[model samples]
Target: MAIRDAGDQPAAGIYGLSIETEPMEAKLAKALPSGEGWQYEPKWDGFRCIAFRSDSSVDLRAKSGKPLGRYFPEVVALLADLPTPNFVIDGELVIEVEGKLSFDALQMRLHPAESRVRKLSRETPSRFIAFDMLVDTDGMPILDKELAYRRARLEDFRERIEADPAYLTVSPATKNLREADAWLSRSGGDTDGVVCKRIDEPYRPGERAMMKVKRLRTADCVVGGFRYERDSELVGSLLLGLYNDDGLLDHVGFTSAIADIEKPELTARLESLKGGPGFTGKAPGGPSRWTTDRSSDWKPLRPELVVEVKFDQITGCRFRHGTKLLRWRPDKKPSQCDFRQIGL
Candidate 1:
């Protein structure tokens, strides 16, 4: 979550677009907007990136305004070699594994070692899926232009430059609501969900001018462990686990959405089941760069309780984010909660 200061701006700039400029964001919605003038695109499962190229200088920036060039050298090289020199684009940085986009592979490219990054780049090369054009090849600013206009220009720009479709691809977009819904229904693997944008409105950087509906799904998980709230004995979060093929319960993720009124009784119930080994394999509280003294403290459970939780995405056999507590499942056995539920 580190933010780069103004001093960190690069010496070379792309048109007038700075690397510190934030990309236009999307607000989450339950469904896509039903009306005309709305364009829908596939919500790619990757990093939101802004790619800039001017002459021989090229830069790749994350949505948080952090530099990403070093981590994706292959993308940088691709942009530097492009026939079109002066241009800025909004895209997603993705890596495909076995024909499906892998967020875990993209995350692995962030290693500090150049040798490790180079090896991953060759083994699993990244792709830039362009969805917006901020600046045209003629140095014409496109931010003030309407989405419809910019999208057309982006298509034309792609053909003019002859950008390598393998590395630099222009994302497909549709105005049909049924098509968008179909994309959402088939959302998995490479596609995360659907993104809806106002075709008549201009690009508003750092603003939630677009809407996104993530493909959410539910799963049954074992209550493998629990963490106490900081400075209090009340239960904080329920650590969720799923049994692998080897019959070992591995910590997939946690859900801290427990209702406050149920904490005292839940805490008591958790304490009673804290005797047996919690997660037999790949347990939580592992050493991580984001780990802290208080965050690492967790109590083990007997793995007898089962709860159904809602999750959006999974990476490396684990939930990419904390899940939402739905309700206890007395009808389902803990052994029934396996990796197959989440398609691991």
Candidate 2:
């Protein structure tokens, strides 16, 4: 018998391709280590997008490789009207307010109503904080080129475009690590973190080539079930789960970021999926080093939902802090959810 190599196989979707998804990701240790050769850039807090411009038609893809053109109509229009026809740019979709990035404003762009989205697009209009030039004017993948060269190409592409407020601008890199640290520190509410890239290294698409150092830690958890608010039919907390050695969903943590009004409906939906082993091996037991006697307050259900959660840390297979509900994952299966998704 021979052991299998998981790394030898390509990941599914666009991740399998040697293409950059989001220019700056929160995994900077690979790109920038202590006393190393690297160029650091401010990590913008916004949507991760890949702008694909093939001739006149333009398509904006989200970090999940989903078509984001419909969600961000204004960006699609701007990309279509760009000077270059065929080019792929990896960047962040941000909204600027008073010379600072505004993630709250960017969140408004996710409206399902096209009319409202178009209205907000005109009112608060988004900007493309382009950082990487994957496909140059020649329509060739520059993944083999050094970071310095690719950045220069990105700069040239920006110069060719008309400085329209609708298009905003591109993000520039800082050679100084101290300055990058300042950007990471004073980023406050605007910046997400700092991304450091090796100047001499080539873009290793789908690989952790560059490095990102975020101010806070976050993790993606499987929503095994949800608990209702006391005395109310509203969802209070989402029961989080992680897979264990026996290939079973195990209760890990919980998130209670559900809104006041939506909780009622959400709880009803969650109650419908109750029963069965919500968690298998090492289920959430009583008080330990991290949690207290309040563990009994939580309720379990059949694992059916998956959600992306943002947390500060993890201790004893549980979240160190309460997580914020980023979004629902109807497209992702519960089995796909696991603790391995957490980046080291």
lDDT of each: 0.82, 0.68
Give one digit per residue, the lDDT tens place, for model 2 in 122-170.
8877888888877887788786788889999988888887667447577
Residue 290, model 2, lDDT: 35
Local error of candidate 1 at 333, Å?
A: 38
* Candidate 1, backbone clash total: 0
Stretches of candidate 2 exceeding 4 Å from the true structure? 1-25, 28-32, 97-100, 242-251, 257-262, 268-313, 321-343
Tens-digit lDDT track for model 1 on 224-334?
Answer: 998887678888888899999899999999888888899999999999998779999999874333223234588999988988788887889888877898667543458
Task: Using TM-score, give the best candidate's number.
Answer: 2
Q: Best candidate, lDDT-wise?
A: 1
Q: Candidate 1 has what TM-score?
A: 0.65
The CA root-mean-square deviation of candidate 1, after full C-alpha superposition on the true structure, stands at 14.0
Query: Count of backbone clashes for each model?
Result: 0, 3
The TM-score values for the models, in the order shown, are 0.65, 0.75
Error of 1 at 128 (Å): 0.4
